[model samples]
Target chain A: MAQPLPPLSRRRLLRGLLAAAAVTALPSPGGLARAAEPLTRELPGTGEALPRVGLGSWITFNVGDDPVLREECTAVMAAFFAAGGRLIDSSPMYGSSQATIGHALERLEAVDRVYAADKVWTSSPAEGPAQIEASRQAWGVPRFDLLQVHNLLGWEGHLETLQAMKAAGEVRHLGITTSHGRRHEEVERIMRRVPLDCVQLTYNIVDREAESRLLPLARERGIGVIANRPFQRKRLIRRLAGKPLPPWAAEINTTTWAQFILKFIISHPAITCAIPATTRVDHVRENLAAAREPLPDDAMRRRMADHVRGL
Target chain B: MGGGAWWSYRPEDLLMFSPRVYARLFELHNQALWPAQLLALALGGMALVVLLRPGPRGTRLVAMLLAVAWAFVAWAFLWQRYAPIHWGIAYVIPLFGLQALLLVALGSLGGGLRLPGHWSVRRGLALGLFAYALALHPLTALATGRGLSGAEVIGLTPDPLAMATLGLAAAAEPARRAWLLLLIPVLWCLLSWLTLDTLGDRRAWLPLLAVIVALAARLWPRAPSPG
Candidate 1:
């Protein structure tokens, strides 16, 4: 026989707990600024000052069942902002990244300063609404700052909804994105026809296919460019492994292979920001260095490109 | 997974000049499990609540809760970028959390401990403490340096060794320390996850072996019986 318990709704307790957790998750004003501190490299966008370095949530923070890692990853995010960094990009396909961001940021309290960007990766009309809602819930924001169609995930009708979101002020920006090398031409074709504000794709030192058309076209269209995988899946590390750091690499304040790669990506005038995701505090520190100072000029960019290509 | 092996992964990695991810995401979520994904998280949360006990159950419950949300977030946002990585650990956290509440609910109406009103700062403190433990995990990974989305031993799967190590470390008062045993499973999940997923498939297999070692150690005979 068990003792009788008082009457109270467990759901209410959960809601209360969630609310409390959310409050706990929200960063302090200083902590929020601190979180964005590392990402303070502002890119000269169409008009607004955007952080030159941002975080990519494609794969780093998503470790199933490792809530500890998620929290650590969230701390890494806080550390990013603390280091003058800002601009984090995520999408629906990047499972639970949005949710993780919400969970982690809910307690931080000062999350408003941080750029909250995620995507809707869907195709069905109903699915689009649900995804946007889900992303909103996961992000814990009523509306998103930038709601993109993930990898061109739900390009047609969802973009239509995005257009509405932009019109109604539910979102500040709307666009389509892709990452495959072979999809460049197709990506280019769509960019030509679509009313887009931003473009994302892989454009690291070793993989320079985007430079041929997508990048140049972005400049022509006045689209703000965001670079991703500046390191090419850490291929640069694999490339530069066992090799000494270049003498000139340190000239731009690059200490590790991570900075060198990130610097190279943002060097191009067309790029607004380069988002490279990392879970380690050290890597975040290294990546933030790219946004701190001027990137290598075109001449240096060419030399770096050639250097890595040769490697 | 849609992207090529090179740098063709991650939604943010691509330029969305004329993006299509919106439509694609819609198609993906509408098919079947999208709605359930959120529910799974809820259920997983519930499981954690149910499984966590004041003595040994309390810590294990908390560990499971931490594992569930962490894994769900990881699968949703980072590692399984394209789809949900369905596994027992993934669902168990919330499942057990909810189950715990259910037991209390049934046990209470049918006769149990009286429930407390509004969660006070005490619960908040507990959460903060739990979050502290979660935050420390990456340090373990960072110390190892091999920590990444795919690093083994401390993922969704429970590493027996990690659990035992954690269990033994907290073994002074097995009741209060039993939850430490959960580290074994959490570490095991992390270790096994290394091979199953990673920043990319190209990551070295070192974490895989580490996870195996952790699991073996957990299975080793010991005084405390870690569930």
Candidate 2:
């Protein structure tokens, strides 16, 4: 009952395939050129290589009508794009964040350069379309690169709507999300039965419960995985503050404790990206820097996790 | 929501805005209300002056002024400013509206005649709270390393206004009526304390302290009203 897919959607799909082919032509993962370049991982469905570090707009970007804070948010976005970051994620539930991101995108004129991801969060199936449209208007984007049902709220109806949107080429990708270690069984069930481009869940140094099941499930399903709460909403970072970075952190090229923790999460083979929200331009750059070359290998990852566990 | 699910949420999880945004809301509110802030300060001063004498007319005047403040804040801050960012505030807005109506009823219907009078510990505590809401609340910005631009004015920002309400309600003629009037302000103070505390702001204590003082003012005896 839906119209045929649009030419723009077809072109984007072709572009993704070409980009994936280009990545395949690049040097081996361990080659010097690849190591020196910024870290990126391919989306399982589209083969689009998204930078492993994405911006999250939770408390960080919900500055409402405060011009000073809006300008500060814009600066953070500008820095994010300059650092080769893409895939800025937000939800309608976060007050004014969608508008804030729209404000920044309009000011920076980097809408075309960034990957816009937002969520549909409402209980009524009837309200889902209106809310998603409102979110797109708030972002000033023609379409969202990805849309998810937040926390599995109204997932049944919203997922059906998102599937139609994807089929109609109204959205590039569709998914579901949960955070703070919530509703995992439902999320796992959705991933098993329904097709999803990505599954976002809490996966930080301390909140590794996702590792036991969700991460492995994502890998098994060939689903792209986005790690949210990479800093456990900054509680982990605050706890690790003033603690020395491990001496061997030099091997993964980590300087600050933020980069050390971030690198540890991204180093996992299944993690497509980690969205760490920030209000500071310096912190955004520092977060992106975590995605750079010489990410910790399997053995180092174990040591890194154990060290933080002991700390 | 069943079982332990409710306990899993931390305070910060429910707080959508940062302290910076919260503080700036007051600053922007103060800026928009401009010279009106001086009028609000003057009303607070008037309430303090009238509380000292405690005549029937004075009691009604205090109630009338407080009613006006509740109406203004309900519209200006809660509805126009806060509800946009916090949909939860929409529910609180009607409570404020109800508070305004209650104060109006107390003032016009002579219910204020029941307000407590005479020099007692209750009266003294009331005076202290009224004076603090009027003069001291704004000065708190300085202690927090912020400028006057972000200062919360009486009747304009909720905290000081709530504190002042508790202060004025201390004199309610019928002790029962005093409790009725103190209900909203006391609840608002507790909610404010939780919000500020979650933001890690030290001033979170001010509302709690005000609540304690206001409670003492109501419950503490007044020298047996002297024969």
Candidate 3:
């Protein structure tokens, strides 16, 4: 049986209340020292200080009308926002993800904070604007923060619409996105010719193909780069599971492999943010923690890449 | 259209179709052909009734109904709809067509549907499975928190048809002949499981489990048929 302790003094009670408030005020920690101000990267064109970590809604948020799954996703989004995440990326190709996002955002009362990013992925040029409109309605947003041409699908036709939308203030920025290193040549051609504001492509420690050409070109063109598949869609993290983090991971202030890999991607000078999709609240906490501390320097980045490659 | 711009490709890009898109495809397919879905459901009910009352005429009717169901699902869902997003499904269309033809031949030539020699635990399990495929498969949406719009009905969708076929075949006797009927449904179960698993649908394992249970019931040693 437990025994009761001494009665609380007024001063001790006051101290306890103050400590409790402080603890409650601080963000939940999965890693890093404490809740530091989230690191931000400027959108090269607009100088908008977007958080270096964003959420992606690919397979993770496509729960379709599952109320339980939607509530779980809402909790995940709540954790993301509570940890200072901003950008939320989605594609119409991701099925019900946009609707799910809208639902979660409505419940969390987080619509205002969302830097909504979506894509147009249809083949018909005539259908491009309509697709964007449908996405807007699905998201329940009046305007999109970013609208990208998904995988360069009918990019030529869609670009014209995106440019008009940007000019008309319906979209804050316009860009193009591709993954799996597909069509880098085509993507490069579009970037060089079109006056675009951003480019998104897959860039993880293993899939370093983008570092060679796309990242450099985006840097050269002053185009903001959003890194997709930072964990190779969980392949990298799953591969590194149970493997110990390098002793030097402390230099980057990361405690988990998810943070280690996410830090590696966003550490690159060219990358503005890395949108890592996650369904779990704990993972969201871990991912958002990567943005709170100083990212690795170039040499550190190379060393981190080598460590994962060696693993 | 440009000299340097050829189509870009990636193996993972093939997996871009989300579970939402997969479910929405079924919803659209059902909605686009409304009354026909009712007719298909009616035919499935008839097949189950005929299968329970085993006779040569009833056997022929069940086979004919299954053949038509497979043919309709293949032409309507696989060839016409699923092929657009997944070009690889085009190759599967022929397999479905072949299954339909095989059923037609089996109905005309093979001995009438052989009911299990006697009631047993395996036979009871097979009946329960068949009833689940026919009745509960459509209510999966309710379980998954989806509306009726997303339901996949027996005889209307390939997964349920494959499931029901395995369940019915498990309940039938003459194990050697039942093996022939088992082939296509087993293949379909494996294929659908892989596709659904890729889409991150939890229901992916259902078909695979059905295959395993049916095979287990089939292999369960039966008491020697009474002379």
Candidate 4:
């Protein structure tokens, strides 16, 4: 016969542990910066300045236990940090990606430079806290700067736990995430109801469903917006590869297709960050370079959108 | 980008690793099991000989050899390696283990398999598949502009190993539970096909083609026994 086990839910168990441990500020091991300070946006209400460009570890960082691939990922992270980029987002669902990030940070010794962001992804409410804790252990962080309810799965329970964690200072901010223009209605509803510090959604130039409602709501609510899949996971870049960049793109100082797409996302007033995941060091540098000054104004933004749309 | 409908999700949408990572897995797996790859080929050769000729001792030997291959793949490739990168692989690892146990049971307990007594279309097709898995399949790496290190060797990688097992099962004369041996390998082939297809690799057709040939061989008429 199996035991029923303790009645304590994972959230409560985590809360108890949080109460016992002293919440210390994460150490900054700075001095990797080699570029001018990249453009940054303030996290809604917290006044925390986050680099407009962040590194995403989705398909790019899930490189198993292979030492070579792990080192390659570390090099990408090194380039990202060297360019004055800060926020690095990952999730439990990304399979070994968090561990890879931890490996990179450990190798680079730039944990201080990274604004660690992760997500709670399990549908089981009781499993949410444990997952977040495991992710924290994977990233080797004291606590994540932001923890989001991934794709709105079991958002009710995970959101409540995140709010509790935020109040307890276990996490600095709480938010929800959706990708590929998914579940916008529910995402918008949560933005209205919850005191979210940020919201992450798929907002590349092609997939702009969030523009009409979610982006506006995020701005109105003072919630920082993170634009994910800025290059549609490299599909958009591949699509625009052979096509010549519009001559007007030079007006915004965009030179490549990646810089064009990333600039369009970060230039939005509501978007606090654009996380473009990559496996190459050169690509990481190019992504961070897009965050430099001379961003696209409203007219240029429309022109950029139209140019890609026409292409 | 379709409205988050579960059905709307394509195979590529679920793939969390890149083709480069997938190729690297094989290269590293091949590197770790260096001399053992030669042993894997030897075992495959032994199985091929047994497949072409029908005898109780040889049949049992082939089954045991397949059992070894399945067990090794379950532990080394799927469990130790792939489970970390692709979390869903952990669930399928046990299926490989179960297939190994089934092969062991078939080898020890006997009577489930019925090998053809003489040359037939099925036997020829079986030999073809064995040859493909053991030899031709690995060359796909070189053909696709990848290094020999990423070759899908029989008994080492799942795709070729599954193809070889399906070949062995197809060569056997129809039996009550012999189809059990084909079940997991067949499913694995379909899955491999989906994964490769999702990656947009043309080699996706290789596994799918193996399935079609294996099934056809299974259904092919057995030659008449000696009078």
DockQ of candidates 1 onward, in order? 0.04, 0.33, 0.10, 0.60
Chain B TM-score of all predictions, in order?
Answer: 0.28, 0.94, 0.87, 0.94
Residues forming the 10-long window of minimal summed lDDT in candidate 3 chain A: A17-26
| The best candidate in terms of TM-score | 4
Query: Which has the greatest DockQ?
Result: 4
Model 2 lDDT tens row, B153-214: 99998889999998888656577677878999999999999998998988999999999999
Candidate 2's displacement at residue A229, Å, is 1.1
What is the lDDT, from 0 to 100, of the residue A43 in candidate 3? 87
lDDT of 3 at B204: 80
TM-score of each: 0.56, 0.90, 0.68, 0.91
Inter-residue clash pairs, candidate 4: B114-B173
Stretches of candidate 2 off by over 4 Å are A1-37, B1-4, B221-223
How much does candidate 1 score in TM-score?
A: 0.56
Count clashing residue pairs in model 1: 127
Worst 10 residues of 2 chain B by lDDT: B110-119
In model 3, which runs have C-alpha deviations exceeding 4 angstroms? A1-36, B1-49, B52-158, B163-190, B196-227
Candidate 1 global CA lDDT score = 0.55
How would you encode candidate 1's per-residue C-alpha lDDT over A88-107 as one tens digit per residue? 88876665567667766664
Candidate 3 achieves a global lDDT of 0.80
After the best TM-score superposition of candidate 3, give how far the Cα of residue B129 lies from its true spot, in angstroms.
11
Put down candidate 3 lDDT per residue, A1-311, tens digits, no spaces: 89999799874564454334323433657643356457899989797889899999887887666566676677777777767889999998886789889987766667798999999999998999888999999888889999999988899999999999888999999999988777788899999999989999888888888777878999899999999988877677788999999999998888999998888888889999999998887788778878876789989988988888787
